[model samples]
Target: MGWCSCINLFPPSCQLSELKSTMYERQKKLFDSCQRASKVVAYRLKTPPYKLDALEPYMSQRTLELHWGGHHRQYLEYLNRALGKNDILYGCTIDELVKVTYNNGSPLPEFNNAAQ
Candidate 1:
């Protein structure tokens, strides 16, 4: 019923609190979307911008070769393969797939990299 009680100028503190609340809500939604994107998004092979030999003084090319060329590449291959079978989950974000496969807190038998 006061000056700011619903129809007039809101106090600075009240306005600030409202602004913070709005930002928090928006940020939370964004975070959730990112999480969901992980599953739905196809695995992309990413390499460092610098040449493999550039960091050789500290980082070895062999390490990069194995990590990027072998492990990471392998992971993507399997993820794609798995996605191929499940039309529903394939399009769904990783977050959704994980939740569905989680079986209401109980994980499915297939721990084949999908769980990770």
Candidate 2:
């Protein structure tokens, strides 16, 4: 159960059990949706944030320096760290995490550190 359902449960006393049932259904729906989404974006190939040679002379052989040596390597590292737990996010997709944490918030604890 999630915080919402717990609140809707005993809080301010009880109602028809219908409220409880409804909250249960909602939480179930959310979990199902998360699961479905995770499956959808799983096992994708890693792509660098920038194009080869985009950085040019200053960063020459730059594609290899950053894309392969840095960005690609980091993706593999992050993948290992992120999958370490059968934690809440164990089944989550890389794309899903990227989409979810695109904004500032409490860091994902594992993924945020791995990505950096």
Candidate 3:
């Protein structure tokens, strides 16, 4: 028999199209589960308890502003972007988000953002 004819020799379950469909269904289920688990929530940056200049001589105002305002805020922005409104991790606490995105050491794309 020709190469094309050999495809029919295999059972329907073993066919390439069937395999792809099965994989697609599994992915769709996962996506749906994530969607169902998510809740809408807003994340905000917390202000430091003390004034930025409180630690003067020990830590400069400019340094604190750069680190807290610039870097920390940027990290939060990136995290919010990564965990878009409908994301599975959306509305999760920072600690929980970090742990989940860590993915048992495999680490998802949002792990860094969550950890930061």
Shift in Å, residue 68, candidate 2: 4.0
Comparing 1 with 3 on lDDT, the higher-scoring candidate is: 3
Q: Clash number for every model?
A: 3, 0, 0
Q: In candidate 3, what are the lDDT values of residues 1-116, reduced to their tens digit?
A: 55544346667578888886765565345444553345547556799999999999999999999998999888888888877843556667676667666756778777886687
lDDT of 1 by residue, 12-99 (tens): 6678779767655653454355434234456567677888778776779998888878887787777777767644445555555555
lDDT of 2 at 105: 55
Weakest 10 consecutive residues of candidate 2 by summed lDDT:
36-45
Q: What TM-scores do the predictions have?
A: 0.46, 0.42, 0.64
- Compute the lDDT for candidate 3: 0.71
- Deviation from native of the Cα of residue 38 in model 3, angstroms: 11
Report how far off residue 34 is in candidate 2 (Å). 2.5
* Residue clash pairs of candidate 1: 39-94, 40-93, 40-94
Worst 10 residues of 3 by lDDT: 27-36
Off by over 4 Å in 2: 1-31, 35-55, 62-64, 99-104, 113-116
Best by lDDT: 3
RMSD of each: 14.5, 10.4, 7.6
Give the poorly placed runs of model 1, Cα more than 4 Å off: 1-41, 93-116
